[model samples]
Target: MKNARPLPSYLVQRYHGWKATTHAENKAWYRRLAEEGQRPRAMIISCCDSRIHVTSIFGADEGEFFIHRNIAGLVPPYAPDGDHHGTSAALEYAVTVLKVANLLVVGHSNCGGIRGCHDMCAGLAPQLEEKTSFIGRWMDLLRPSYERQAGIADETERLRAMEKEAVLVSIENLMTFPFVQAAVESESLTLHGLWNDIGEGVVECYDPDSARFLPV
Candidate 1:
């Protein structure tokens, strides 16, 4: 523990400022949230892109959402083989424990993780193919989606298609969990897919009826 690092001064200062301002202003609400515990109605699985601010975009309150962010916001195929599965574990907790009414797999435009997966599959990023590469292995979950979009001829359109596919793929994989499947079947849970364009400030929701992403 000797080499453990302390938080940066600016971040610490910001925390202090928030503690004195936002925290003080919303003291009762914060205290109630702490004492009563969180009961978020929605669970959001989103990319860990700094530009994609899920909370800010949705104007969600502190305890309104149970959010999980990873490289591509991916959900691996359910395998109860007693292995470490962080994303799947979180998904299980959300669907079973939290019992969120809505589960959203939110993908965003210009995802570096998706691009990396595309490049790796195309033999452009050799580093990602290494067995020791964590990102590479994690992105393997998204490789199927990349292959699904292989028919697209234009690079830009294909990239966009793959970005949207990330959400679609996660939704498909999420259903592999028995609890999630049960919840949806009983109308206890509703699954949603969303893709955001950060630059254009546009959001699209996947319509299962039309089988296309429509502006929302």
Candidate 2:
């Protein structure tokens, strides 16, 4: 990060203002969180996109929700054999140690990762077709979704469907963890899925029984 530029002055000034106002007002709450440690009620795995604001959407407070973000908010199928698994590690800690009651996978429309997967698989992104491309390798996680949506005729609908598919796939992948499965069986934990329409500023929650997303 040595080459990283300094943060803009405006952002720093805003932070100072928040410190004097928001932080000052909630000093005791912050202290309590630091002292007693966080016991979040849910773990939200979401996209790394700037448009997807997890805490803002849910109106979550500090230490209220354990959040992990990745490209397209994907959860790769349970592979305990991998050498480096950042998302899996975070999930393990959240489920087993944190004992969060709810695990949520939130995906959004217009995801670059999902689009990249569509392009790379369709031979649109020649650069991403390279085996060594990290983004390409990461985007492979969503390939199953692409295959599933192969019947969709409209390009826009396909993209939207893929976005939702990412959420559904993540929900399935969460079960691949032994602890997660055990928790779900014991009724100690529940899984939820959400898809966001960034332009519309609308969110839809996935209903397992209905197999559809209802407005939230």
Candidate 3:
């Protein structure tokens, strides 16, 4: 019995149930989306953290949002020669092709990439250099913020500040894309900065009025 083939019972059952219900209730909707392609209303630039799910957090259904996830949700400034521009490419597709009305940069608390960048920049992780990893390169985007915030006495405060600064930087980088800039200037699209603190299940939006992340 132990050697007998095991089927993915839970997943298979759940998928079958979902498929039946969705096909019954949303067959037309699904067909229309498939034929016409997705016309998502918003584009979310977020971290690859498994806990930070944009769809679940926003209560959005399929085809509602175009999402781009990267390390620490960092968006590199427009560079002509940067070969690894996955985030930029996704942004272009969302803005130019999908024509999303809103672009959101969602940063989260307890971000591992942000913490790694902070530690590496502050010389707290000297052993990290031995490993030739993409994380080191990806976190390079936050180097400037790390340098500026290095003097903060409290590690916790410094990490928080870096996280916020990283979001602001990504927003600025988003403008570096010509399509994004044109969309914003033409009033066809709006940019937003959001922070999700998972531990407390608290979400904060960057309030331009006070330039602070306030609970939503």
Candidate 4:
């Protein structure tokens, strides 16, 4: 592309460092993964937050999880409307092709996308309310979540709840896929919702029994 540029110096150095050490150490395992293809046990849909390291958090290997990152980790409802659906495409491939046994929608603390949705819904962000804003349109998926948490009076509490609600919304939307429903009904696939408190270094899992997020 015309605007394309070489990798930054620090990134390049890091890549070389990783290639010489970690990649070298895991050469055989990497080779095996390449030859056999990936058979990930789970598919994780998470936010594009730099701090929330999914693999590091779980101590997962490269081939163990199929991860898709997007703003606020939001998942839209099953819409086969022929528009460009990156998240849905990834989900379909994970469920139908990879046959991942578990699908996790992970949300995290102080999510900018979630905050934007909160502000936009409250009529505080005019830019996000604009028709041409991609983030705005994408975050519309979480509008229901904002509305659901309107009863909360405190700003911090309401935003925190909205963050968790994003995970719920994604999980609920994931089930809308026909293949996902089939796999789940047959007990082949299980769904999970998770909220990670980045600063606190705590991960909470959604407990269906109590309908609450309990620490993992």
**lDDT of each prediction vs. the true structure?**
0.91, 0.92, 0.89, 0.95
Please provide TM-scores, in order, for all candidate models, with all chains considered together: 0.97, 0.95, 0.89, 0.98
Candidate 1 residue 135 C-alpha distance from true site, Å: 1.0
Candidate 3 C-alpha lDDT tens digits along 1-216: 779886789988988999989777999889999999999999999999999988988799989999999889989988979576788899989999889999999999999999999888878776554467588877888899988998999989999999988999999998998889999999999999999998898888898899899999
Off by over 4 Å in 2: 1-6
Best by TM-score: 4
lDDT of 2 by residue, 31-116 (tens): 99999999999999999999899899989999989999999888888897858999999999999999999999999989999999
Residues 133-156, candidate 1: write the lDDT tens digits. Answer: 999999998787778888899977
In candidate 2, clashing pairs total 0
Positional deviation of residue 33's Cα in model 1 after best superposition, in angstroms = 1.1
Which pairs of residues have clashing backbones in candidate 3? none
| Order of candidate numbers by TM-score, starting with the best | 4, 1, 2, 3
Query: Whole-model lDDT, candidate 3?
Result: 0.89
Identify the candidate with maximal lDDT.
4
Per-residue lDDT for 1-216 in model 4, tens only? 979998899999999999999999999999999999999999999999999899999999989999999999988999989899999999999999999999999999999999999999999999999999999999999898899999999999999999998898888888899999999999999999999999999999999899999999
Segments of candidate 4 deviating more than 4 angstroms: none
Angstrom error at residue 93, model 4: 0.4
Whole-model lDDT, model 2: 0.92
